[model samples]
Target chain A: MPKVTFPRMGESYRAFRMLMNDLGNEVIIPPRPNKKTLDFGVRYSPEFACLPLKILTGTYVETCMSGAELIITSGGSGPCRAGLYGQLHKKILNSIGFPVDIIVFEAPKSHPIDFLRKVKRVNSSRLSYLAIWECVKRGWEKLKYLDDLEKTTHALRPRELKKGSTTKVYREVLEWIDGAYAMKEIHEAGKEALNTLKLVPHDTRRAVLRVGIVGEIYVLLEPASNLEIEETLGNLGVEVHRSMFLTGWTRDNTVKETSGILSVKEAAMPYIPLCIGGHGRESVGHTILYARDGFDGVIQMAPFTCIPEIVARTILTRVSREHNIPVLTFFLDEQTGKAGMSTRLEAFVDLIRRKKNAPVSDNRIIVG
Target chain B: MKAYMGIDVGSVSTNIAVLSHAGEILADLYIRTRGRPLEAILAGLTEIAGLLPAEVEICGCGSTGSGRYLAGVMIGADVIKNEITAHAVAASIYVPDVQTVLEIGGQDSKIIIMRNGIVTDFAMNTVCAAGTGSFLDQQASRLNIPIADFGELALSSSAPVRIAGRCTVFAESDMIHKQQMGHKLTDIINGLCEALVRNYLNNVGKGKEILSPVVFQGGVAANAGIKAAFERALGLPIIIPRHFGVMGAIGAAQLAREEVEKTGQTLFKGFKIAGLPYRTGSFECGGCPNNCEIAEIYEEDRVIGRWGARCQRWDVL
Candidate 1:
């Protein structure tokens, strides 16, 4: 059987690895993206390509270098550069002498049968339909558990009495979830993790700033690429609510079809009448939703030269003006300095706090 | 008799300002950093200390600008703020109804949009150096004219030529071409100012609503030529505050006062700190593959501060 490898995105790799493993294919999960990973990608990638593309290419190269013969990655069917990443990666890898079979899953919207066929290829065991269904069900359970642990950590980080306690508990819980072999064990470990998080002392009285983070999925999910923005925000006493999750994105793009995706498109209609590809529409839609839901501020993070997010950003300025909600955008690249980013974040937080605490008659609408 | 002190240690300059309880500037000094922020800060502090009366007490101190953390640690600042917040706060105090603040310092420029005395939107020009003060200074010297005289000369021009100001290199070559084309020196200078103003408005002020009561300040505010160009570009009267050059320091001082008022205590290290020996060094951490170069600040061989590691391994100590 061919050894199949997939790039890491948050905790989605856990479910992907399990599903691939259960299907009797030898699975090799590339190491978590770190500085070395980013450096490799940066060295091989076009200078102006978005950070995610470079990182993904780097992961493929690393996995291929480690003797993996087959690479599985997603494909997009939109105007965004992401749709072409798979083709570009294959070309770049082959030119670099790393010959490997590449499987680019077709977008379910255009080629549902092809997507199903590609998925079934991972099931080399040729198990009974019931067995395959059971394997998928177990994989999903673990994915949901991981997502829940992250959500709890996000909520508790800003409120924890002890600085860094939430992160400590979050790391331990992730370990527990990753180590669990059975569905029952995963649920038990998740419950124990939630209980452990709850035990951390917290201050409920402090008026914490609530911020909505909307942006490109890779930059949003990958902590190393974004310089740990969530952790930085949490430490600065701001509670962050991210608009994207791995399972949520997967469901919206595949199983649910247009149901969950339509609401966001509808919300973004007044601002962006057309989908500009990638997560551009979703970024605008989520910001408007967050503003209407009374978030203190919205922050949009995207890689430099990211066309889709740039289009969304220009529209967001108008959204911010019309709705009276503050919006800050950060364009991340390889040369982005941590200190500069931190300074901007600090200034933004201070601005939000001052606006929130100001007297009501100041002619500024209190959004949160 | 008590005063709050604010220090702004920037890459190009170090500024210190002392404010009375009524938020009045008592003493302020602006000194070139000359690649030595520590020495510049010490010299600034020593100068201010010598100018103040014996009865005046230094109650609180704050730090801001790029070197804020280092200066804050060295001065024992009660409050440490980023340049944006410090600049916004200071601009607000100078013009209570300020809606827009255009700050062009030595190496960086920023546009801060305000609504109801609160900063609503802001953009900084860290990536581009064309629209900043240093570029203007460079042009002034290349023209064989003092930077102080360049602005006044520009104001005297009857017809200002157009110079491409998208980037420093292009603008410099364009200026040379115009000079060879036999344009009047004053016309060329005025055109340079207009080019910088155009670049700033397009880059830093892009997609931002510039509302008046617009207050323009920073080291670059001294240029009457740029001020006139801004007024023409925005079609509004640009107000330069009384203490334009030291606004960041002033804002830092104001923030220090606010912090001290709330806590009724200050962590000021006193003027004697100027005499202490401080040194900074860096070493690459090998704990992980990141290999972050951790910087450490030493006072008489005792490490006072350490930073630059991405992970918490070197941070917690």
Candidate 2:
């Protein structure tokens, strides 16, 4: 059966809780991510336990303790610490004296054997098939809505009257979206929001650049961790795309396993080729692709201690120069501040606008 | 007219090597991966294809490294081996008498001990990055020194100082403290080198039987300081091969050669893997009480591999 988990996210925890309630999987939802969860993971896990690793391991432990025979999760084995996390979690939990039965869905692009096994572990009689399936579809729809909203609103928000008001509204919308009950309601609300958003009168013809955000999932997704860089880009009239979403990650993993026996051409790239390997392959690939696709600039994001993204950022300078694209990288962690990130992004956006004639904001308040 | 393609997908970088039947590299590529290896492997293969003549017959294909399973699946690789085996195979092919293999990458580092051309015992630090190449990169950047010149900087030290080599944070802080105490740049840099060696020895190489005719590879091989430190600490003249950076690729390619030789055909899916739309995402696992945050990658809506599970029991499921 699918267990609900809040993980370590404070921003999305409540939303996940609400969704679990609506989906009727509220009983199995794991606790929110915390230092204790991380401790549970780090103590039992390998020395260099990343935050997500700790949370996942801790969540699995908690689920097993709750007498759950089978738990549900997704996994990948690739360049990021994330890919191997499934294996690491299993090892760590077993070593820590837990009899937790681990069930994971394979990457959407790889072999189905792992996921198939997980499905078997779950007693079909105990599972609410309708609820679980419905939850995923709804989640996908929500993702699509957010993706669409980001594309439309970002196009003009850079030139908005209040400049940062669109981002302000975006934050409000994300908060509300967490509580949104039905797809129809979200769509209706999104349309209404977009109409009101256009009332602010953003410039339609301002040339915009594209920025790719990559690195640790937590730092990339949580604005508090990364200083709301995506929103800052939006303010600068730059379209931002964050790699490591729920969909693409699944796709890459599904492809990675079975493809190994397929051929050497694709085998060379177990994750995302032409990108950063080891740590930040997505950022590296996204950077190159952004350049190849004619994006004016790329911004690489990561946590301070993350080696893979740092490696990718360093090599990105060579790629940036080789491809004649401007690349800026930021390292975020618990200690990161808004002022510093804003300053860097401000300069990077300015440089891109000048080189590519993509107008962006020069003045913006530091987001905290 | 004939060639072998090897793909090395690791936790840090993906490398592709195309070798002539006579064991000469026609072309090779190394790329740091943000988190995905499939794309990196494909990119390297595609690049080599662009640079090579289409008439070149790919006799065999091999995949190795941490992401070997996925790599083999994507490219239809004939041979898949653990990094230690792959590295040993490639090293043996180049220098059959190689007794040890030292590989330090971005996220992880390892030491493979070999005797009589076979792996004895190996220790790998998959969860630590204290002495890896990325650590060196960080220190060099903090010192505002060019990473390319990092090795030479340590080589210039007349009297090297010692810094704590236990972890990157301590080593960096100790270096800073040494700087505050007015140590020379060369000496400080050398201290950093010593720290790297100490960390590697104490951590990964702890009590391992390290014999020589050793080969050092991976990203950190470029650092002369680390190489020298290892030589001094081990009391052995360690040799680093020319294709150090792409050892994984070379290994992957060598494995490919073996596969082709044995199977009499190639499993390479070809070089045009670029058009495939790839995507990835993450979700917390709900299995058991262990809500493992699971990451899923997709290629046109299919699941490939699932890792990060602490329970290998999922495999049987």
Best by lDDT: 1
lDDT of each: 0.87, 0.66
For candidate 2, give the lDDT of residue A213.
61
| TM-score of candidate 2 chain A against the true chain A | 0.68
lDDT of 1 by residue, B33-58 (tens): 99988789889989999988788898
Per-residue CA lDDT of model 2 for A1-368, tens digit only, reads 34433343324343445444555453455665433455565566555555456556766777667654444455544555666666666676667676555555655445666555554455343446566666656665656555555555656566776666675566566655555668787667666656655666676676567766656566665444455567667766787765545444433455453331223224224333553434365566666666667777766766555667767656665676566666666654333224344434554564455455423324334799
lDDT of 1 by residue, A1-368 (tens): 77989878876787788888888888888877766777789988988899999999888888888888888888875798988898898888888898887888875767888977877777688887799888888888888887887777778889998888888777777777777778788789778878887787888787799999999999998777788899899999999999988878878776665565687788899988887888898999988888889999999999888999989988888898787788888888776358878888998898889888877745556799
For model 2, state the Cα shift of residue A353 in Å. Answer: 60
Residue ranges of candidate 2 with Cα displaced over 4 Å:
A1-368, B36-38, B284-294, B301-317
Please state the i-RMS of candidate 2: 20.9
Candidate 2 lDDT over residue span B2-46, tens digit each: 988888887677888888989998888888765867677667766
Candidate 2, residue B245: Cα displacement in angstroms equals: 0.9
Which numbered prediction scores highest in DockQ against the true structure?
A: 1
lDDT for residue A217 in candidate 2, whole number 0-100: 61
DockQ of each: 0.49, 0.01
